[model samples]
Target: MNLFSEIRSLVLDALAAMQAEGTLPEGLSFDNVAVEPPRDAAHGDMATNAAMVLAKPAKMKPRDIAEALAAKLAGDDRITGAEVAGPGFLNLRLSATVWQGVLAAVLDQGTAFGKSDMGQNRKVNVEYVSANPTGPLHVGHTRGAVFGDALASLLDYAGYDVTREYYINDGGAQVDVLARSVYLRYLEAHGQEVAFVDGTYPGDYLVPVGQALKDKVGDAYLNQPEDVWLADVREYATEAMMDLIRADLAQLGIKMDKFFSEKSLYGTGLIEAALKSLDDKGLIYEGVLEPPKGKKPEDWEPREQTLFKSTEHGDDVDRPVKKSDGGWTYFAPDIAYHYDKVSRGFDELIDVFGADHGGYVKRMKAAVSALSGGTVPLDIKLTQLVKLWKDGEPFKMSKRAGTFITLRDVVDQVGPDVTRFVMLTRKNDASLDFDFDKVLEQSRENPVFYVQYAHARVMSVLRRAAEAGIAADEATLKSADLSKVNHEAELVVAKKLAEWPRLVETAARTNEPHRVAFYLYELAGDFHALWNRGNELTELRFIQDGDAATSQAKMALAQSVAVVISAGLGILGVNPAQEMR
Candidate 1:
């Protein structure tokens, strides 16, 4: 059902014909030839760069090749016309039957119309929202969670076996701080006054963990030392914070396939094993790094440290694996984590990190490259900040979190559907300004409303058709006489439907789920435009006066739009609204 692919196949066939007739060279490669929508719709339905790409290799003028290719394409049954434009590009207009057939395919496949096999069931590990287990997820982690979840769903729709994982940052100083914070709360529960100073988590979310600890141990830790309480309380508080985190993600309808603990890498020889793998490749060494860029030599301390030759694998500088203090650096555990992922036999790995972690991208990729011997590819996607606005003013922070807004704050203001959809309206790397006033509006400016309105409008049409005694079931509509759907406005929606399969493959290939959001917005626009057009043109309406066949045919096209909309929203983890509130 990929119309672009079919047209590209036709272009390739025409090139083969040219070669057979000796009009082109015998061994010209057609790999670069592409058939895509024309930049301006006025040019034609589709355009190809076949002649321009083959001109230099085939020793022929681009115009001559384009004219010949146009002649061959014009002979196809689906191609109504083909003309050379702008020296070498060939513009093609498909027959009306082709557009009608696209709608038929949509009805036949339902929501699965645009699903792609581009991934070929490749195993992809998507690690995201590896937040510290100190508190509930904040707004920053919310964006990463939504983005990563949507990406995993999008890849799954494109036929990839994706594992959605969250790496718990529990093996760091932060967990120790959380343990101490919970200890203070526990002391407070025992009727003792306590103070939370710097380097300790003081958020109210940890209060429950403290009370739970008091409930469990009672006065056992009341007079105990740090060594006696630290280890037990660290484990206890981490599990509690993780429970809070899991509940927060559940509020957004996000559930990870696995929760990997950073503590599992410590004292397990895993970090040493990962480093040994790199050392065996001659990538690990003890060396003093050069003075950092823009820093004077005196401003920096030159220390010989155990480092990874990350520069050899694409990093800007070699990264240290162990500090000069003889303890492991922060990157050591991350390398071990990725090495674990590669050892799990995943073909590809994607890490969804916050924008603050941008500096770690190259080093992480280099480590994965060194560990996997360049067999597995690592792609890191960074999610930028989200600034919330209410009534044109910056939204206030959460007192519960003590610093930033929590994920529950956003989800509570707007439901999970609106939150998820709006979060994906912008690319992951772009900063988004989420305005509560604007996003909740019913106007076209809100993409969530616009897309949902289109789906709701289609549902209304189906309901009316059902009430009018017209059998609008799937079987009846899919068999409707689509020949009556020859209007330009009707064909526009069908043409957009044809782009779904192509769009899915493109979005999956680039690992950008925002493209799906953008595409769904455009498709909804086309459907809405056609719906508005029916107001002035009586015959274009989904329900005719007495022509049941025509009404059924038009309803078929409308239902196909809803189907695709549902499919796209499903990938975004958004439930399509059947009717507007």
Candidate 2:
């Protein structure tokens, strides 16, 4: 199904033949040999670097080897011709039937055509959107949520056993703030005027939590001291905030497999266990760190602290585990969390953090490297900022959230499909400008609308064919005689369809889900190109007038495009639109 792979295999077989014929060395490795689309389409369909990579090893000129290999490659059925280009690059043109077969392959596999085994069933834990559990998820968290969710789904499609998880930061000062905010709301529920002071949450989202608290225990802690209500209200407010966050994620159709609480690490000896693992390896020690190079704090001084020798594994310097105050540093709990993940026997770990957390990446990766002793690879992805634009001006502020835009606000305006698709139209590390006015437009310039329109138009063609009493179901179309439907434009779509499986493996290997978005866009473009050709050439139309045989064959091609679109959207966690509305 992968045309590039098929061509590469042919090239490798030809190289093996050349080795036997004594045209090349006996043991030169083919590891670096690669078959890729030629830079310029006019040269050929595919090109290989086999000659260049093997020339020095074999002690032979690259052009001499390329000419010999090209003659051998020209004998293969899939490769119609092979010729040496500039600097001994071998350009290959695949036979027309190979492109024709790709369409049939797509029809056979449907949406599963591009699914890959690149992950090899490895277990991977993806931790993302570990936002503070003190309020509903804002727009900043929305980008992380969508990026993480799409990444998890992409790995799953690539055959990894992925756990989509969120960390609840409820054991910090933020939860205490949530408790005091809810206490005020609780008093207000009991008919008392309460003023929110500095360091207290004043968002309306918590007013309901406060009212719920008053309903649970009416007038019991009305004027009491902070000791009794602080502990209980903190628990109450955290659960309430999590509910709002879960609802916001649900609006985007995101549901995590797990939500790990930071509070669970408290008093559980978990921090000691994680640190003990490092201690046993002689990584933990007592030392004083030099102050950060630039903009040192006024009170900065050398203080004895328990540290982890993170520099041994690639950190810029050793990191502190516990401060001189005997309390664990913020890094300690995170180390324990990752240690727990490693002990669970995961084969790999991926953390999706905001771009602001860039400073923490090295130490975190060092911890995983030490904890797993290089057995597991940890990959960290940082998503950049998302700027909002409207009315030719920077559209700042969230109307519903008062201080920031909640994830729900964006989802409600554009729907979950638009939110997921638009977020992925750019690479995760690149800042994305989201124009509310432009994203909602129904035109080719809008990628979301354009991609969805391709799928919708295919469905419309099927519906019209069905009304005309020609069977256009997947089963019927799949059984059509595809050989009768071959054309230059039709073959172009099939060739593009053949790239899906290879594209999936490349995207998964790079841990880049934006490639999936780009692939879908290209696939849609190819399908659209073919669709427009039908307007000028009646024979190019998908539905032939009163000719069910040719109509079934053409419908088969259209449905093949849908198959790839659905699979690509599945990786991005967006639903494929069946209708334009």
Candidate 3:
């Protein structure tokens, strides 16, 4: 039951009636008409911009259209009052029974109250956490992981067919370095001392991998040169590192639907096929690129390379597909990967990258556009850095990871629920500070704690009702006489509940999951305010003394708050707390 949408429908019907009666001109489009919450709650329950948008098209004054529309709306039972404000805007006041009906609908639907079908079941692939498969995931990957996972869940709730994917960066020089690093560890396992040079990994996490390799092939490649052992060791070390990364993701309750290997695109003719598709459209050419913008002329040298006409789509300059040495550039493989996705029959593609990859956004979008012939759209979201703090000071690096803090380092300090919730408190492109001490504090300043406490408080009310011999189950609450729940304070919470369905569609359309966290916080604040007011006024309490009928009416509102919070937390992949510890 979306009250805003329902009211907008009513306003549209009124405009149609006015057109038929010649009160307003015909052939005016109502697509821009919108009904939303008023900025000042004291003004009215809802506001509409129908008059302002239709005035110029109908060749009529805005105030004249607003007055006619207000009279038509006043005839309906749902709208008790409609007044013209600021010459064109219409402020509407709904009856108390309408807000009460919203609470009853919450009880009827439970956690499924705000689900939407706006996506129309379109196939969408969300690829994230595509870090190099050379080591365990670090703090930067953690932010991208949480944001992407939450977004996938949000799209699913909005009725999209979503596939969560991870692209393994195994076909790069870093994996070669990992192979040599494991070889050093294997030599150490055989009682030989080896020093880690500047190119090899020095983290202690590889000790076990080295031991495992020695157990598999005993003294076979012990003294062999690079050619004899490099290929085998590269395959073995990449598998080991991927296993570590999988475990790190499991720590946060994340399980991807697919893990695409970059090495699979090599020597498989996929790169040639993707480039051929572009070449057939006359987008591929050989040209000499200009020197970089900030480079000195003496330090620059021009060379002929294979280039793609990326500027034709939207990129600032044409991008290189192959280097001068006849080898494919890094962007070549990425193009092939997206072509593979398009061939798999996906309607849309979304890439979640780190903030440092901002330079690749325009080129990547251009490639997908040219490959799909502008039929499919690609959206790229970049997650900013996460700065960790301990005891009001900067946190130190992890010993296991050698230089940066690993994902497990953050998850272990505070459990996965807190880590996931705090990561989404800010926008994906905004920096976040995760303070170990402040997040764990049981205070209102902590958003996770505040939101959790609201759910826990509702549970406490249910328990108290049970002890007092009052029936407060969902079935009983759904059948309660909600007409008695007409207090202004109680109605305020119901009004907020009416916004959930609308909020879900807005957040999903914008691809912003942080808006869900923000809405949950605001709903919690409204609920907490009513709870505090009940202390001074006994009639506002959930359990009225000696009156089970009125008590059930008030308890229904509190229970509805918990239902929405649980749904919101489910979208964020955080478990709703039943009780505070």
Candidate 4:
């Protein structure tokens, strides 16, 4: 069903035939040979660089090789014309029947038209939005959550066994800080006036957590010492914050398959086991790290410590596993967590982190490399900041979150569909501006609206056809005589539909889901362009006047566009609009 792939196979077969006929030398590698859309559509429908790539190896002139290859390709029924361009490039035009088949395939496959088997069922662990369980998730974590969830869906569509995971940062001193903050709130719940200190959380979201603690144990830990209440409150407050986070994610249609607790790695010998694996490979050592570049810290001193030889595995410097006080460093638990993932036999690992954690990428990759003995590969994607604008100014901070806007703040303003679609409108590493006024605007400049409007337009067409008593169901569309869809403007849409399977493979391979959004926009533009043309050109309209056979043929083309849009939107975790209000 992939027209590009089928054409590439045909080109390769032609080259093999040329070799047999002595038009070219034997045994030239075709790995680099590519068939793709030409840079200038005016030149042809597709272009191939086979002659240009094989010229030096085969000891033949590129123009000569291209001429021979063109003759061999002209014998095929699919290719209408193959002409040699500058130097050795071959520009090809496919027959109209090829595009007709592409439209027919769309009706046959529906949303499954572009699903790929490139992954071959390899297990991949994608860990994202591993924010600290201190409060509800903020805007930065929202971007990571959307990106990670969409990536997991894209991988699944590409045939990978993907696991959506969240690593909870609950083992560090932050949880103790949360416990103290909740204790202050607990005192307030007990009718005692309390002021939140600079180090404690002051968000009103904790007010309920404090009341829940009071409801569970009435007056038991009242005015108690730190040792008596800190442990119990830390556990209770962590679970409460996680519940809030889960609710926030649900507001955006994100659900993780696993929520790994950082506390589980401690007191479980897992940390020691991960380090021992590194030690067995001579990657662990007792050494002193050089002071960081630039002005040194006031407390900087040469202290021998347990370190990992991360430099050998691509890190800029060796990292410490233990601090001078003999406690595990912050990076120790992360190492153990990744090591546990590798031990689970996943073939690949992906981590989605906020832009501020760009510095942690090399060290984390080094840890996984050492732990897996260079078997499992890790890719860390950093989602940049989101600037929210409203009423021609910056959006104010959420009163509930105290310092930043919560995920619920964004989702509540615009529903989950708009929020999810707009979050992926930009690349992950690029900064994005989520403008409240602009996103809600129903115009072509808004990608989410443009794509959704196209789907809605197709639904309108189906409804009109149904009222007109024209049978345009799936069965009729698949069996329609698509030869009537012969106009160049209509063929442009079919050509774009033909690119869906290829687009899915490219986006999945590069781990970029924004490309799906980008492609949907382009496809919508082409379909809208054709739709506008039908106003003046009576013959180009979908429902031909009293011609049922011709109308079903053109309706099939419009429905096929909707099919691909639904498939693309599905990968992005956005619902196709049955009708745009």
In candidate 3, what are the lDDT values of residues 421-492, reduced to their tens digit?
Answer: 999999999999999999999988999999999999999999999999999998999999999999999999
Per-residue lDDT for 1-581 in model 2, tens only? 67787778878888998889888879989989999878886787789999999999999999999999989987777888888998899998887778768888888877878787888999999999999998888777888898899888888988999999999998899899889989999998888999989778777777778889988998989889999889999998899889988988888889999999999998999999999999999999999988888846886888999999999999999999999999999999999999999999999999999999999999999999999998989999999998887777877666445577778777777888998899999999999998888999999899999999999989999999989999998788878888866798888888788788888888888889999999889989999999999999999999899789999999998998888898899888888999987
Number of colliding residue pairs in model 2: 0
Per-model tally of clashing residue pairs: 0, 0, 0, 0
Candidate 2 has an lDDT of 0.89
Which residue pairs clash within candidate 2? none
Which parts of model 2 are misplaced by more than 4 Å?
295-299
Ten-residue segment with the worst summed lDDT in candidate 1?
198-207
Give Cα distance to truth, residue 131, candidate 3, Å. Answer: 1.1
**lDDT tens digits, residue span 1-581, model 1:** 78899889989998999899988889999999999999999999999999999999988999999999888877899999999998799999999999999988999988889888899999999998989999989999999999999999999999999999999998899899989999999998888999999778777887777888999999999988999999999999999999999999999999999999999999999999999999999999999999988999779999999999999999999999899999999999999999999999999999999999999999999999899999999999999999999988999999898888999999999999999999999999999999999999999999999999999999999999989999999999889999899999999999998998999999988899999999999999999999889899998899997989999999999999999999999999999999998
**Between candidates 1 and 4, the TM-score winner:** 1
Question: Which model, 1 or 3, shows the larger lDDT?
Answer: 3
For every candidate structure, what is the RMSD over all alpha carbons to the true structure, in angstroms?
0.9, 1.5, 1.0, 1.1
TM-score per prediction, in order, is 0.99, 0.97, 0.99, 0.98
> What alpha-carbon RMSD in Å does predicted model 4 have with respect to the real structure?
1.1
Report the candidate with higher lDDT, 2 versus 4: 4
